[model samples]
Target chain A: METFQHSFPSRPLAWPADRSWALAGVVGSGNLEVLIEPNPAAPDAVAYDLQTSIPGYADSWKAALADFAAHYAVGGTRITLHDQGAAPVVITMRLRQALDLLTPAQP
Target chain B: MSRVPYHELKARERLAAIVDPGSFAEILPPPARVMSPYLPKLGIPVAFDDGLAIGRATIDGKPIYLAAQTGQFVGGSVGEVHSAKLVGLLKAAARDRLPCVLLIESGGVRLHEGSSGEIGIAEAIRAVFACRAAGAPVIAVIGSDIGAYGGMGILSACCDFRVMTEHGRLGISGPIVIEKWMGKAAYDSADRALVWKTSGGKTRYLLGDANALVNDDTAAVRAGIARLLGPASPVTLAAIEARQAELAARLEQFAAVTSPEAIWQARGVTDPAAATLDDAETFVASLAPAAP
Candidate 1:
């Protein structure tokens, strides 16, 4: 497995006072699971810890995550992913889904 | 009205859909990220829940502990953390005197983890008996196509009651293994009908293995679970002896039987073909109540 840690700058993620975490997707062939948890210790960036079965995709992962951070308010949280060769599109969707589930709905 | 097929639902989705709405309180959820420590070393991608999503939940307004296995994850094989969660949940049910439900969808032990998975299944089996002895019914739902196999089949058999569906199967050695061992002429795994008849819910329910057989829909499965939520059968010497004798009698009676059809016919399924085509509700209705 290729495991790595990275952080991207983004707007402060608004979290719910009642919830601790949110999760989306499952770790399977061509799929992955995204786990988002509060990271009060780091309030200005979204930290990522990723482990993928198919290695040599670090650049693509970083680019996708960086784009997600820029597009959404996901700072101040730690997202951990367990992937099994999911495509880039699927990964982006799972990250967004996890973040959406973690944060409360906006007006 | 048609409903979401329970077999198609994932582990967490099964828990959320079957139990009372918003009743699932996960013990060690994904965010906890209690992943497999061994998978990474083997260059295998790990699941945050270790392929078993276990937690507290309510069924029909009655509090119960529930666990759902993710069949997509290495065939929902039981590894260290996965089986440990099962043991912990069953133990908690025993301590609290609450019923425990297992929505099992596994092919057996995770072969990738080796003996760790095997030992874990053994521990989980012990915990199942512990809960049963405590008068806390350990109800298993063998309603997924993956069904219970290997150690899981043994564990499920230990449960106080089992709810199965037409899609579910329960057996130690699945068709492929039997076919490989006995040769194609003896047992053809490619024959889907023969395979299902051999191990599927209908035959098992007819043989008194599965306590309940319902439709594949989540709603039907939920109702099936609700029906078996009452008192558990006491684990006593007399019960064990009687069960053993019954099994022995069944084996002796069907020892020479060549097909599952004959077994079904012997069990009073007058038209095995017609009975096989019947839905879960209709099928059980046409037969005598399964042995206790």
Candidate 2:
């Protein structure tokens, strides 16, 4: 298993008032779970704490996370992910899904 | 609109679908970071909820404690953290006099964690009885393809009531373990129909093990759980004695039975062939008055 933490600069996120945290996906073969929570301490960046069962993919994970931070308004959030050999595409989708759960639904 | 099968949903999804909308407040949620310490050293991925999602919730506006195990994660095996969460929830339920509901989907103890899990299950069983003694009900809902096996099966039996679906199964050692030990000729695990007939909801319900059997849909499951709620039936010495007698009689009557079909016939299933095709609703409706 490989463990790492990284923070990327992004715009401040407007979190829902009633929500504290949100989660997506499950930890299993070829899958992962994304847990997103409010991190008021870091208001202009998205922080990540990642643990993956398969090693030697730290570069891929960092690149994908950087892209997610740049594209999404996930600043001021701590995203912790547990991966079980999930592909880069799956990881990005799970991140999006978690953010969706955290944000308030649109009318 | 088509409904999602209760068995096919994940742990959190099951909890959300069954409980009252927006009522689930997780006790030690994923953000709490109470994860398994043993998995990291073993090169295994640790889930945020430790493969078990436990929290406080409501059903039909009545406060209750709820738990759902993730079968996809290590077969929903109970590890140290998972069992501790369960034990804590059950203990809290007893203290608060709130009904505790468990959505069990475990293969057994996490062999990875060794005796720690076994001891954890034992402690959890004690907590279950503590709730029962306090007049706080402990309900087990086994409505998943993984079902409840091993120590979880014993814990389910210890609960006040069980709500099961046709997809649910309840047993000690699963069919695969039996087949692996006793050979295919004795108990073929590959025989899916035989496996279901052996420990499935229909057989358990007919034998009076499972209290209620509903459809596979989440709506039906929620309704089934709601119906079993309210006051818990008191456990007494007389009830235990009667249950023992009933089990003894059942064993003596079917001691020589080999096939599930023969057992069904002996249980007053007049048309065993037709009974095999019957769903839960039809099976219960077709039961003769003297069957029990």
Candidate 3:
């Protein structure tokens, strides 16, 4: 619900040999989706751009993104989120989930 | 309680009827008060609950995730938060590998929110496909007269199956819009019978678009959904090609036909008049493709 944006620095992702992009979440009420795609231009700085309807807590959004970037090695990717009113917890969780799905730490 | 028309029933009531008695455990219940953020901006009163009702329930004792749209609230349209909840529910169904049942009574995307709803629908469609890809069936039940229109119609078509009743109608543009486009002489919106005949459940069923047709009774609708809770029909390249051809043939066959009676006859109703007069049971039995 809060309007926010932040970019965190981490190691570049090990780009998948096959796919181009993957998206999760939907642009619906009280919820937002995250889309991750290969940004060949800047594979070292994972860009996080968020547009939210309920604006106010830009800091909370930044904190969530900072934590997600610090936790995951998603630097080589471009992360775009369309958020409605997701709690900070859900935002972080979805970010992690999308990262895991895209990179799949193990496989 | 049962005397009320299906369309008159609230979203929750519709869900209750289609699922097992006392089996529903609504996730994100109304107490959570997760409602639309855009309605109030447009001076529309927001429902205590979001336009959508979603949760886990059982159909004939088989567990599934159910989603119902509240037509009374904003034509059952999807808004930002509403659509997100829906997407989340479908994803949850995929994660749990459970069947997702949608009681569709929407007029498609909520125009108030503009592109947000449009994008939400596109995302939801992708989520629906994700479930289908994972072998979880997504069933759409269309019994309310509001039926499923606009983008929802195409989404319904993409579902694993659709169940409808005679009162239900499905299409992109509603009769009024069509009438406006073609003028009253070409399509009369006031002619309820003609409207029903064109987009009604019986016609859709006869065209093989509707997988099942039951009475307007909720119990019957529930039973129909129960029958198709497990199978997934992933659209493949070959299947898409076949559907394209079928649709082309349909357009070609109906090109010269202005009235629905002609459509029925073209589809091999020996006596179109009598066939239209027949009840669902007899009409279904009497159906035959026009002799090639």
lDDT of 2 by residue, B32-132 (tens): 88989999999999998899999998989999998999999999999999999999999999999999999999998998999999999999999999999
lDDT by residue (tens digit), candidate 3, A31-78:
556767677677667788776767677877777787777877787787
Regions of model 2 farther than 4 Å from truth: A14-18, B288-291
Per-residue lDDT of candidate 2, residues A23-78 (tens digit): 89999999999988888898899899999999998898889999999998888899
Put down candidate 1 lDDT per residue, B1-292, tens digits, no spaces.
6789888888888999999999999998876768788888898888889999899989878999999999988889999999989999989999998999999989899888889999999999898888888888989999888899998999999899999999999999878999899999999998989988999999898889998999889999999999888887789999999999999999999999999999988887889999889999888888755432
Question: Which residue pairs show backbone clashes in model 2?
Answer: none
Arranged by lDDT with the best first, the candidates are: 2, 1, 3
Error of 1 at B125 (Å): 1.5
TM-score of chain B of 1: 0.97
As for lDDT, the candidate ahead, 1 or 2, is 2
- The two-chain DockQ for each candidate, comma-separated, is 0.76, 0.88, 0.02
In model 1 chain A, where is the ten-residue run with the lowest total lDDT?
A13-22
- For model 3 chain B, where is the 10-residue window of minimal lDDT? B283-292
Candidate 1 Cα outliers beyond 4 Å, as residue runs: A14-18, A40-44, A104-107, B288-292
Q: How would the docking of model 3 be graded?
A: incorrect
Please state the interface RMSD for every predicted structure, separated by commas: 0.9, 0.5, 11.2
Candidate 3: residue B68 Cα off by (Å) = 1.0
What DockQ does candidate 2 score? Answer: 0.88
Clashing pairs in 3: A1-A85, A28-B80, A28-B81, A28-B84, A29-B80, A29-B81, A29-B82, A30-B81
